[model samples]
Target: MIVAACVKLVDLRPGVDRLTGAVTPSTTLGCSAADRAAVELALQLADSWSAESVVVCCGPDRADPVLREFAAAGVDRLVRIDATGAPDSADVAGLLATTLAGLGADVVVCGDHSLDRGSGSVPAFVAGALGAAQALGLVEVGTEGPGTLRATRRLDGGRRERLVVDAPSVVSVEGSVAELRRASLAATLRAGDVPVEVVAAPGLVVPPTVTTRPWVPPTRVQPPPQGTAALERVVELTGAMVERTPPRTVELPPDRAAALIVEQLRAWGYLEAVPSEPATDG
Candidate 1:
């Protein structure tokens, strides 16, 4: 049996493409904590069932660093689905379904939600595409010997339901379910040389999305305040008009007056000093 874990390389710090105004993944690539847990779950399943473990990723060549990282953590195979630009959810699901079908994967493990979009709908879409059984939002997973699996899923109001799932199944798990194991130095060194298999994603038409600014109410025009006196007009226009305080005359000596003026200026933020460095004699 072969178990495949689907992972994504999200941008730790995303940058906007100036020309297209689309969000671009940065060089600082890393999988989400939930994806890390999915990989770990796949590895654990492989260990228990003696099944070959595979980690599958979908991204461009620049996303190879994350693939290498997963390899070091010890999956039997690393496959990169060649794709560029941000594919829509349905397109991504189609790509994954096609790849998994080609691999003859008996089990597919994935994180419940992606860091980019928290829709958590890809696993369901993949299951639909492949005509496979799905157990999503699982908090616990275990084999039921041979072709069956045991899963406990989270429900609304902090409730969990246990399920018995048949094989050729896709399951999405939460990050808190498992932690990935550490890789030894030798394994890390060897992972760098383990050639990653590249597969081209099947061409799928991503549905176009329409984006528009929020609707705002138009500005309301009102007639000028009907009042004869300026103060009455001001009162009508503002609803509440504050009278300015009259300036007071003060009697003080020149030095005291100067000091008081300087203090007032400082309080009003008009006496800020520039940072300086000691001059060096050259």
Candidate 2:
């Protein structure tokens, strides 16, 4: 069995300059937290199945370090798709799908979303391009049979659902469940010597899809007061304004409070309504 782990190199300490709204570079690059989880999961699965693990990435030359780190960590192969500038998510997905297909990967693992963009769309796009079953936000993965992949997916409201997918499937791992392992000194030294196979992107035109929108400050309007209103304004300025009443609080029984919480949840569409039983004539 062969497994491919798709990952992205992201800013290690990502943040925005509050005053400028511009991304503040931490001057470091590494695999994203989500991708690290995906890679860890892939490594674990490969070890369990005695399969080959491949680390794949699509980015510029700056991403070489990340790929090398993964190679040192334990991947059998390291492939890098060198891109010039930041490409669209669709283009990146296309490149990854193409590369994975050429590699003949039985299973593809990736992070549910990229830390930089947080769009959470690339994995699905790759699955669609490959015509493979997709399991998103998976916290656990294993094999049920020779050609079947079983996964536990994290859902909303802290719920989980187990799913079984056939071979040639794409699994997007959740970051919360993936903990990366440190590479040994020997492995690190070996990784430094491993040559990363570089591939050029296909003849797909990547148009500029992202643009910065100008920020506009809000404006407030105040109508001119005259006659009675003007007199009231003058009185207010003279410290004779009426005092406002404080809000009142109410306490309810434990059961009632729980019911109210449930009602609020339902009203806000956070809870689904239970279906009613079918009516029958007796």
Candidate 3:
């Protein structure tokens, strides 16, 4: 069994400085807490199943430090998809999904969201690319058997849903589950030697767009109102012509009020117009 964790290095702020209007050549990048939890969960699953644990990320060389940290902690393999940065989530997801498909990943884990582009859509995109089942935004992850993983999803109104995900599935976890464990000094030193497998990324596929005229409502043709007097035309144009029954206030005996309500209900189609029993002379 192979378990792969999808990790990302996110931008700390906008590239352009707002005050100076100068291009901020250097942008800070780091792993999100949710990504840390994702790696930890992958480690747990890999350890439990005695499967190979792999961490894959798409970023420039600056991501090496964070990748090494994942290695030191316990990942068996580190994969860096060749990319400086993705223009959008679609590109990143494509790169990661292709890599995982080649890896023949039986289980794919991802963070609920990233620090940048927090739509939490990469997992869904990856799953769609691989044609695999996806269970996202899970708070609890575990295994009920050798081939299926059990999870709990947190929902609105303090609601929770339990689900079982089988192998060849994609799962996303929230950051609140557990904090990532620290790597030991010895492990860190050993990780320095671990090789990061770099994979060439596919070209980004931007959506096809065509520039055209700005939108404007089409002119609608309407027949002239019959015998258009200025007053009638004004009323018609302003929509002051009324058709619905006007509201009425009625005071009646209890029995009569009840009958009136029933009659109105019938008129409004709320009640069936059942036929009254035929009156017979005794």
Candidate with best TM-score: 2
lDDT of 3 at 173: 91
Model 3, backbone clash pairs (residues 3+ apart or across chains), number:
0
1-282: candidate 3 lDDT, tens digit per residue: 899999888767646544445444355677788889999999988999999999999888777777988999999999998776355677888888899999989999999899866789999999999899899999998897655899999899999999999989999999986678799999999988888999976676545433344455568787665646888877776668858789999999999999999999999988999799999999
Question: How many collisions per candidate?
Answer: 0, 0, 0
Worst 10 residues of 2 by lDDT: 208-217
Stretches > 4 Å off in candidate 3: 13-16, 20-28, 205-282
Q: Where does candidate 3 have its weakest 10-residue lDDT segment?
A: 206-215
Candidate 1 local Cα displacement, residue 257, angstroms: 63
TM-score, one value per model: 0.70, 0.71, 0.69
Model 1 / residue 167 / CA error / Å: 0.3
lDDT of 2 by residue, 149-251 (tens): 8889998999999999887988898787678789999999888888889989978666763544447576668555343787787766564665855555558
Give the runs in model 2 whose Cα sits over 4 Å from its true position: 13-27, 209-282
